[model samples]
Target chain A: MKITIQVMVPPYSYEDLDTAIKIAEAALDKGHEVTIFLFSDSVLAVNKLVKPVKADRNIPEKLSQLIKEKGLRVEICGICMDYRGVNTDMIIEGSNPSGLPELAELIYTSDRFINLMA
Target chain B: MEKKVLFVAYQSPVGSVWPNEVFRTAFGMYGEDIEPAVLFLDEACVTVSKNTKPELLGLFPLTTCHRLIKRYGTPVYVVKEDLERYNVKEMEEIFNPQILSRVELSDFLHQFDLVIFM
Candidate 1:
């Protein structure tokens, strides 16, 4: 089954992103295809410049590693990026820049859609 | 079959983008393979009241959303208590909106494959 999980809050702004990752991990382990849709401030999750101390969790790197290791498809909303002045060059390497049309396709094709937001 | 998505709006549109954002997503994703619906709860019921134009206040163009909802026959639900709480006389621009009691809404909500809260 295809599952599209939308994250709409900034990374570490809340536990939404963390919970979404765990859900993705569980879903992937069950042999489900996962797609992460980044909307609103959650687009910041893909920023390569978010540096955290060694003691704290490096949230953006974890997202990148998830893309590299678990074959997760991550799509950051283009309109939302423009609102926050996020450019393609500023995002992590693996994720793709997308728009609402992509969101439509994912919602239609996916068997389940989970939104992580306030 | 396409997945069912329910947008549960609990916030008022006053000085907030969340309410209109749902309609934006709905307009973008409708007419595809997804079945999208909106449920007005809490203060959001005010937006559905007759003669109130959210777009006139420079929010998302709700007129366009109304057109899409009419064109595509998307389902709209509202809690009975919310209408009374918000003092909304009626939900306009929507055809045959389902006005369910809280009890009925609780059961009706689970039918959808996905729930997005705003």
Candidate 2:
């Protein structure tokens, strides 16, 4: 299945976004093609400069590994990132700057669409 | 088959729009072909409590929620820990929701085809 998962919540505030990443990983392990889009506060999940608490999962690093090792595609919303003052340099490497048009395209093309926001 | 939707209402009624949105949407989808289930987790357990009356704030009435469940047969569930921790009493008239443990709740969430958290 070509699955599109949208994460719309920040990492430290709750566990839903992290669970979204883990779900994408599981879907990949099941031989499903997974694409993740970060929107709203979830744009922070890919900010390399932001350090998470030791108790919390390292979201940026996990996102990088998902892109580099698992070949998972990721897009961070450009407007949302800019709204939070997240510059291009602060984003996790390999995550493309995406707009709402790409999100709309993904919605139309995806076999399964899941939005994990809390 | 109808799409199985699990609405996770984990927000409190204290100035949060989550309870209202979840209830309104769930009620709206009642007559639709979708199979909708509501799970009250964390602070949202208060929403299904018999004592809760958001109508005082010009919000939806608790009786309307009862009517939705009675008329549409919407299944309602609550996290046992949250219900216990909050000490929610007089639970009989509040939809008579099924209570599940934390681990059980996680397992139950997987049963739905779509899960939306509020």
Candidate 3:
């Protein structure tokens, strides 16, 4: 089954990003296709430069590893990245920059589309 | 077949984008044979109050909320105690919601096949 997860909140503010990662990990482990679209403040979750000073888990590395090892398709919203001043140079290697239109297309075709927004 | 879907809104309108989008989605959810319901709990009870003016905050107008109930014929529910705590009096002409006590609200929640919280 095709499942698309949209995360629209920053990691520090809440658990939205964490929950999205866990859900995506479980879905991939179960052999289902998982696609994650990060939008709004969530675009920060893929910034390779920003590291959590206190948190044990490195979110960006975890996401990059998910893409590389688990075959998770991660996309960050272009508009959101611009608003957050994130460029391709700062984004994690595996995730691609995308737009809402592509996210909408994914949602239209996916069997389940879950939006986790703040 | 029609499925029972309940949208539980706990965020106050105009405080952020979430409540506004949730209601907008609820408005769009109504059509065909779909059974949709809305439950405003906690701070969200203020959105249905006769006094809220979300437009003044440069957000979705509170009047559009009236249209949501009138156009969709969606049953709107709010916790009576919550409204009391927020000091928002439930006016049927304005809010068009059925007042539900805590226990009644819990039972009402169990009837829905899907319950989405915002």
RMSD list, candidates in order: 2.5, 7.9, 4.7
Residue-wise lDDT of candidate 1 within B40-62, one digit each (tens)?
78887776776667667766655
- lDDT order, best first, reads 1, 2, 3
Deviating ranges (above 4 Å) for candidate 3: A1-8, A35-40, A43-61, A64-118, B28-34, B57-60, B64-69, B90-95
Tell me the number of clashing residue pairs for each predicted model. Answer: 0, 0, 0
Q: Note the DockQ of each predicted structure.
A: 0.66, 0.10, 0.09
lDDT scores in order:
0.82, 0.78, 0.77
Clashes in model 3: which pairs?
none
Candidate 1, chain B, TM-score (2 decimals): 0.84
Between candidates 2 and 3, name the one with more favorable TM-score. Answer: 3
True-vs-predicted CA distance for residue A10, candidate 1, Å: 1.7
| Tens digit per residue, CA lDDT, model 1, A1-118 | 9999999888876887889889998898888999999998889888999888889887778888988988888998999999999999899889999988999998888878888775
Ranking by TM-score: 1, 3, 2
Looking at model 3, give its docking quality level: incorrect
Better of 1 and 2 by TM-score: 1
The number of clashing residue pairs in model 3 is 0
| B1-118 per-residue lDDT for model 2 (tens digits) | 4667777778886556566556655665544456778888888898877778777888656676677678877788888889889988768464878889998866798888778785
- Superposed by TM-score, candidate 2 places the C-alpha of residue B39 at a distance from the truth, in angstroms, of 0.3
Give Cα distance to truth, residue A110, candidate 1, Å: 2.2
